[model samples]
Target: MLTFEEKLTIIESFPELTRNDISLGRVNFHFEESVKDKKVVVYRLHPNGNGFVYAGEIENSDYVTDSKGMVNIRDFTEKELRDVIQQSIASLSESETVTETWINNEGQTLKLIETSGVWNIYAGDDLDATHATYHAAADYLYQEGFRLL
Candidate 1:
């Protein structure tokens, strides 16, 4: 089992994470640049060497999560710790970095952009509409008798 200090050292290795101590000697790591709902990844470590990591949207596999869907990091190695932390941070970061422009069949120009997971459609010269997802934004224009060019 990894000691508490060993776990702390491994967690501090990630530069993107900022450590904040909570009540009961527990610590929380917050990814400031994250624009998603899970910017904070939960890490609970106990003196008994029992610990857990929750990186949002857990997968099912050996040592992945309990029936409650929490990752047991009690016996996790340095590699295991690093991998989970990296994934946790990435899962909350913005998924898009560029804007794309397309034209409709009627020759109307449409600019598609995503900001903090909100998709926007700019038709012609101004921001025309907003949608929750990129696909939804595209679908809205399609329903307006717009066809991809």
Candidate 2:
């Protein structure tokens, strides 16, 4: 389980969450201390590696969900998610690494890697779809500041 401070640190590190009044990836992250609260933080992400606003949440030590109804973190096991979140925050606060691998047109495997930043991957050969997925992943990662790796 992550403390409120840890969660807040992660949320604040995200530019999407911290800047701009009408940001697409903005999320309202807060905690109510008086009672045990389940906080929901909404953001955008591509469902099929395309572009979309996919809401998600990190709640009370045990439950995380995405807008696509995909439950990445659930029950009491969500502590691992929290840990990932913390790692992401720490990475962004300093520097982070990201790597991507995919097949190119020659039926040969290609790898596009980026360090101290984020990178996206696409499965198909459509350039437009691939570009969209890359942008979507960048936006999602910028907003959430976390990924499954």
Candidate 3:
């Protein structure tokens, strides 16, 4: 079984992850990207020399991997570690969502909906338009001085 120091050393080896951003607990090492978003990736190490990497809050297999097959986190080399972290970063970047109800000076409520990589804009009960990216949607809203709620 990997000791606490060994686990910490492996985790800190990631250049993107600052050692200060890691919280080493008795059984898990919680490492987070220093982004504005609140989501984090956790490595839950078991006492049996095995572990799993959980990407987000939801308990699913999408970004979850165990110590088996192509994914054994316990046996990952430095290159594999970089690949995993890069994968997680890419996933997190694409998962960014913009959901807010903004009110304009004219008391108009503009709804911003982001789903499946598409941005939908609605003015009241009618769908005003759709944007291909969150930036485009936000830019349209900003043109009208909408205050997010």
Candidate 4:
């Protein structure tokens, strides 16, 4: 396992990591506290590479993609990746909650209902309107630190 210091060093040196914005040439890391204090980190590599986010514990391995894309991490080691994931989880566990709203494109009212593992969308009089509404809702949830499965 990579130590915290080692992880910090790798993160600082890695040209792929971006702490400021989520765009090409940047990686956005977020930690979620809801899932047993789980940490989530997302990497948005340059357009040429696959964009993905690695998340989970340092002792055990777990990862998920931010989007469907590929990336080359030749400069980093497995331990470094582990450290980054660990640090990200720690950081997100202490963050504040951010709320956002989702609007229907057709002026149809939409509602967010908490389901067991996912958030459900309910549209008023228009199931088709759910497409845009859910898209906005997913975006809002992602911005607020929720991951889609």
Candidate 5:
């Protein structure tokens, strides 16, 4: 729970940032370096008085950490920081699907996927069979094409 002034100061420390880029929250943004580009950096603060740095397109995933697993924002280089952001954006752009595989007694592989926050049978696109939980979604798959597999 850093004070607003303290958080503002932290963001301002980056040569790329100005007073206008940050807002109080679990995360903040840095646009100084990317003023002429589409890329922007993000910082997620920790309760331990340090913060994690992310750049480029953002996603809901692990925070960028150093080689030694330090999440402190000051521990990363410009390239390292940008790499983390690029990796996350690439992974997210590659697929919105989260899938788990199961094998049947007959050795058939069944893949269950959740995409766009909805769960459905991946092979069938059974939109009407959507469910709120992985268990329910997989159950639907199991009942449909995987019952005897």
Candidate 6:
């Protein structure tokens, strides 16, 4: 495991991340432009380092309010930390929702989702109903009172 100072040096290398030293010898990194507004904290030496990177608004995840779907970065190497930080910041700019959606004049909505190598459709955010192909998903949507828009 890298020492706190070593970690700090590596973290400081990223100019986009502003540093803020918190209590108990811990450090927090801030990305002001991030949609998921939260300080990325890398802890002092601990078995389960509180260090984490925000992963945006993911539901059904372990992250609580203080962490907007933060993923733990415990005992990370230089490469690992850099990669996680990059990905976390990147995630802030991306749509967290996994499905693509569209609505009709009547306000009824449809969604096309791709997961686990299969295409699926939903009335709104989602519904498990998997379709075999993109064409199949499109057909399902067409049959459900939706049109290409």
By TM-score, the best candidate is: 1
lDDT of 4 by residue, 77-120 (tens): 65545444433443334332222334544443444543222234
Question: Candidate 6 residues 10-127, lDDT tens each?
Answer: 7777667777766776667876666555545333333235476665543333333353456666667776666555445444543434456756679777767664345656544324
The order of the candidates by lDDT, greatest first, is 1, 6, 3, 5, 4, 2
- Work out the TM-score per prediction: 0.54, 0.26, 0.34, 0.23, 0.27, 0.47
**Per-residue lDDT for 142 in model 1?**
78
Instruction: Point out the worst 10-residue segment of candidate 5 by lDDT.
Output: 120-129
* Winner by lDDT between candidate 6 and candidate 4: 6
In model 6, where do residues sit more than 4 Å from their true spots?
39-50, 56-68, 94-149
Alpha-carbon runs more than 4 Å astray in model 5: 1-94, 124-129, 142-149
Q: In model 3, how many backbone clashes occur?
A: 0
Top candidate on lDDT is 1
| lDDT of each candidate versus the true structure | 0.67, 0.33, 0.54, 0.40, 0.47, 0.58
By TM-score: ranked, best first: 1, 6, 3, 5, 2, 4
Global fold similarity of model 6 (TM-score): 0.47
Alpha-carbon RMSD to native, per candidate: 12.7, 15.5, 13.4, 14.3, 15.4, 11.3
Better of 3 and 4 by TM-score: 3
Instruction: TM-score for candidate 1, please give it.
Output: 0.54
Q: Score candidate 1 by lDDT.
A: 0.67
lDDT of 3: 0.54
- Summarize candidate 3's per-residue lDDT along 1-149 as a digit string, tens digits: 45545655666654444433323432443335434263344344544445544434322234344432124466655444444544444344435354888898988788786744567676653347667898888888898798787
Better of 2 and 4 by TM-score: 2
Q: In model 3, which range of ten residues has the least summed lDDT?
A: 54-63
Tell me how far candidate 3 lies from the true structure as C-alpha RMSD in angstroms: 13.4
User: C-alpha displacement of 112 in model 6, angstroms?
Assistant: 25
